[model samples]
Target chain A: MENPVQPLEGTTSKKVFWSALASGFLTLGLLLVSFGVSGVAYAVPIAGVGDFYVEFDKLVGKGYTFYPKMGKTSSSDSAPQGTNIIETLTIDNLQLYKDFQVGGEWIRVKITASKPVQISGLQHDAGLIEANAKFENLVLEENNSSDWQKQFQQTSSTIVLENAKLKTHYLFQKTINMNGMKLTVERIKK
Target chain B: MWWKRKFMLICCSLALLVSSAGLFSQGIKAEERDTEGFIIEADRVVGSGMTASLVTRETSKNDGKPMLRFQYNSATIYGMKLTKQVHSDKGPVSITLKAKGPVTVYGMTVDASAISFKGACVKATETVPALGMENVVMVAHYMKSDDSVIDQLTLNTVFGSVGPKKPGQLKVLQDLAGLPLEQLKKEIARISAGHLPLTCEDGTASEDLSGPIGLIPNPLDEVIGGVTNPLDPILQPLDPVVGGLDPVLDPLKPVLDPVLDPLKPVLDPIKPVLDPVVGLLEPVTKPLGPVLKPLEPVLKPLEPVLEQLEPVVSETTEAVEKTVQTVCQQVQASGGVITKELGLVLIDEALAKKVPLNQVCPTNSSVTSIVVKLQESLLNTLGLGNLLGKLIPSDPMEQLRKMREEIAKKPDGTVIYKP
Candidate 1:
């Protein structure tokens, strides 16, 4: 009876090992197929900056502030204290959504704002964003401060960019959760 | 082993679910929404708190359906504001306020303190009610309704007026719209009797309206009557003149018949002889017909070329005539001897004056004829005519004469005498 029980346990161990190996192969094959077809599962997320200062020549969506207490309090802060301030806003193209429904009635809402827009202090969270971007005369500065949050509280952060353009569909102050996201930067062939 | 199988199944299911979600997300990203019928463009447009003037024009699509009932050419709104508030005791409430300038609808321009709009749904089953207007003043230079034209309109709550641009135009429009209905039915009854008295309202009778409209007297008919009415007096007097000449012609016919009767007897014998001559010529012409038939197609393309050259040929002929007159006057002033050296000098003078060589001494010009005759006389006087005549054959001389005759017959200068 001891010999029979040892043989049974050995058989069960061999079956379990084969099952695990097969499952690993199946999962790897599925991952490969999905990555090959969708081509978006390999993107790296962007880490948040401490001071959160950015400057672009054009931005095409709404702007809002998450930390109202740290906002600018100078005389030039034209907007209400907590609200986001746009320095020089220009809207190039506006499209009305004809079929937008609200409370069982169609309300004409202009939803699409295309290009030639400018704003200051933009905060955004996007699951996926595709853009044709150009960066000119870019300079990166690193703060040596140990306490990064203290820098924002001391002064209003200012970044100046010249002749920069970024075209994407991501909106400010909106969070989207997508299965996968891809960021591809390819040099245009003349 | 049972736990390992369950684990494997769960892993496979998770893999399938993730891949399916990826594919579905890709599809959603790639999908494009359809926006048809309407397009709006503006220099500056705000999503809310928009204040701008609007100019709208009505137009139809190629399929005879209204694409956009109203198209705004310059409707830009800026600085829109919307506010929303909520209380613990009460629910939330929202308010939107808009301020617009002058609005142009169709051909009328309206200035109002407040204007409201109701946008219709895309489906035909739904209808949107119109919002009311306040303190509106509509001014139109010209307003057209149905087929009638209102020249100038100024409408307000207190005063309104409509009239034609000219005094007589309103009467003309009234007559044109009203007369056709009753007159067309009467004319149709007279033209096609026993058929149902043609009603203008019927579908088939509408097609027959063109017949009555064609019969309506136009300016061209009045112009024709104006031209023929004056001729009536002149033509009436000629009728009596013709009647008075008929008696004089009758008396002469009786007297001339006696003499003409003897001539007819004399001329009757020549008719048989001429018939045979005409019969002999027919065979020659019959064969020429087939030869000429093939040339029609070849000459048809040349007709336009010849027509285009006609004016140029006439202008060239006039230039040649002018040049010959000038040259002849100079030659006659030089005593018409036309020595070879003198001829060369005259040609150099004409060239200096920018006269074309062909026009200076055109091939068959009277000046050229006189110059040739003088040259020939000079050669004969110098005793060289016999020697030159011996070198050139007489056939060439005869051909030259024939070419000169052909050029003289067509004096428009279109022909080029090769000889």
Candidate 2:
């Protein structure tokens, strides 16, 4: 048995406060957790805030806590208490198992050999959410309309992954290796 | 040598027992549970009370078929690559997943087609195992659901061939084929209504799908049950009124029928005289149909635009009226005259007067007024006093005396600088 790597100690492992598309994006979700014996330690030098994943090869969590937005529209209120995600996610291939509980439960994912992923750029922003809207083309007076335009402020995070790699193996199947993946994240400022 | 042989035998027995226990307890099999593609699952969690799951709730769009959602925080896919060969393809694919804790993916399957979903959304099937520790298998294959969807759209295309064809329909189909897995599940919900038993006992596949076709993009149907036809609601009360009139008409019909029977023979004889007139008009009215058909294409698109603009135009007219009223009031308050034909205001004549040497026009200082009078007297000796009077609106002395008698409200509240 090989020992799992431990990294990101003392630093805050980013907690998810997520939402997806105003339509379905506000409904979509993306969560990344790595675990092993004690607490799994894996190190990536790329520094950023918020959830931005390149490849999901090795999964070692005792169990996952998924709080999907129950409502139709993706709003800050759609996710109550701890799980409010207003975002849009683009996934390659995702699958889950019915059982494998260590106290709770989690699933092990193995990326296919031919379908190695390289997430060069990522934008995790839900589209505009407007309320009390005037006409789309109406040029509002400059005086009091400032408050309404505040909703258009761009507060979304962009993520770029550089030098990414994935190494996965199966007990009864062939192994898959992914290397030299580069990802870029750009911010759209208002 | 006998002791060493016994030890070897014990070692072999221990190894055999362990292997047998693993097989019986876990049911380890090669071809049973394998997923080829990317996977997310709740594998092993740190604490208790943590639950990993796949959520596939249908949304309102794409007939709720596009809302095939993988709501679990963790899941896995053992698709084709996990089997004898590796094949990785893009979407227009649907699948069902069984989630296991510590997230071991099992019993996942896929079916792919050639048509694109455009941006409509793809259809997918999702499954969850309520009981823990159940083993499942992943499978892969191609599907043929696009045939029905194409048939529906082709029917629409034939009917909508006239004007402003929505190419977006084909685009919607093509993009729906590639909609992300979560969005695809939404479409699947619209198609399958959730649970899809894709395979049958005899190894035949029959999928019952009903994609939303040519239905006017109606969000209001799902958006809180709005009034579909505005006029229908207002006119609904008239229906009861019309129905009640039948009883009144029924009693009158019995009495009136016998009285009108004698007129039938006379009315029938005139029909022969009207026949030639009708035939003569038929040839003239035949050309009107083609002439009127061309107007439909131009007016159809503008109908909705006009409806939307009607309220705006009315509101704009009211706003302009309010603005004119405000301006008229402001002008009146500022001591100006306004009427139906014209608006007029006049400045104080003192402002037009030239300053007398060192004193300014409208000056009140006694010292400056004396200096100005002295300058006037000197200029008057040179016959230039008349020129000064014409240049200025009035003498500074006369204007100062008249300022005290002006009307009402302290004269614009005496516009003072804050300083």
Candidate 3:
């Protein structure tokens, strides 16, 4: 019996040490979640200025906002703002989720794609329109690895308003990949 | 050692299970709920809303089977949606969508072919989408019911009328053909009832026809509509008027009646022969009188000349005929053969001497004798008395005779002939 078989003193200590190491690794992993963590923020200026003016500025800024002599913008917001600037936007790898404007009028948005795609829905006022629109000649682009990690593929979308009051909620969203894709959005007044 | 190994395997299995659980649960909520489907082939977005349908391109490999897609943003899905909510309705249904710019709607039914549509700007109500640039709008009403669009009225920007001009009205009216008069009246009445007047942004009234008219593309002809013909109005009432509308008189009838004027001679003294009513050829015959008169004076000298030359011509003709007859008789007499080589040599010698004289007749008997001898030699040499007979044997008579003889001598069983 070799001195009545002294209890194996080190078994519990070995088990405790291994358990502690496993817990430490788990904690480190929790602090550094890696896959699928996106730092993309999709936001449009909504409040500070009037709606159509914002659209007009966006059109002027984006270079797609043009006023037809016959078609008129909303009667409100009399500030004359016209620029020949061509609005060029590039989406690195992020998707366009919404079109928000703070004011009283319903505005129009124009979206051009480099490649053809099936648009999922035309949403306004939070799921107001149940139908969808398909567009041709949509511009799409891929993300460049040398760019910032948050850079995404780009895409474009657009819309316009007829009798809608400014500041109305006009939001749009789509699911897409951005390894390399792009789209452009422009506005025109009616 | 065995127990330790078993324990390690158990721990590994639990770790695998725990890690997989965390990985599998880490999907985006939006993507998880997204019901993406077959790619949208084409769509028309009207106003600000999107109307997309599954499209099989003119070059798609889908074999006529339509695949549905969503029309969202600027992209459409190809047929794989997590879930779908189909909205179907009966009766009059109208859907209003907000669209950004000019857009089109494309769709197909379960048992129907795909069709595309554009929004018709309701006169003062809606505006037409422009070209080149993009526009925006909220609330494009898509009326999908058969009777929902009873009548549509649009403003005539070009003509500035309540509606389009005569040709335009004719176009719209032509579509009403085959419908009963009562039906036309009923349709018109219905249109008038539902007619919505249009106004410009400045609030100017365009025309009175604004209210009772629903302007639509002429189903028969694509033209704007309106009319002015009185008789045409009875057939297709583009415009209606009161009873005094009887034409003051047929427009074609002149205001002054020649019948009532006595100053007009009972009959003109003489009607001019130059009247166009007679014929346009009157001037053509005018030159004939002078032309025929000059022909007499000119032909008089020609008659004398012709008479003087007649005897000479007759004598010359007689001489020529006699020479031709002599030559023919001589040729026939020489065994119907003339020595062409001797004739050619003589002609060549005569021509070399610059004599206009040619062999109109054979001058030497030796030439005729030579021709006859040559003919005899040729006939003998070619084995030909009759030329046609010598050239074409009559079915090989000699061979026929020999063959008949051979047939007579054949052994009884020598030939196995098939019929």
Report fnat for all candidates as fractions from 0 to 1. Answer: 0.00, 0.00, 0.00
lDDT (tens digit, per residue) of candidate 1 on B260-318:
99998889889998999999898999989999999999999999999989998999889
lDDT of 2 at A41: 21
Evaluated on CA atoms against the true complex, candidate 2 attains a DockQ of 0.02
Compute DockQ for each candidate against the true complex. 0.01, 0.02, 0.01
**lDDT by residue (tens digit), candidate 2, A96-177:** 1111224444433222323332222222221111111011111101111112221111111211111222111101101112
The single-chain TM-score for chain B of candidate 1 is 0.17
> Which 10-residue span in candidate 1 chain B carries the lowest summed lDDT?
B150-159
- Flag the better candidate by lDDT, 1 or 3: 1
Task: Give Cα-based local distance difference scores for all models.
Answer: 0.34, 0.29, 0.30
Q: Estimate each model's TM-score.
A: 0.15, 0.17, 0.19
What docking tier does model 1 reach?
Answer: incorrect
Best by DockQ: 2
Reference-based TM-score, model 3 = 0.19
Q: What is the DockQ (computed on Cα atoms) for candidate 1? A: 0.01
> Ranking by lDDT, best first?
1, 3, 2
1 or 2, which is superior by lDDT?
Answer: 1
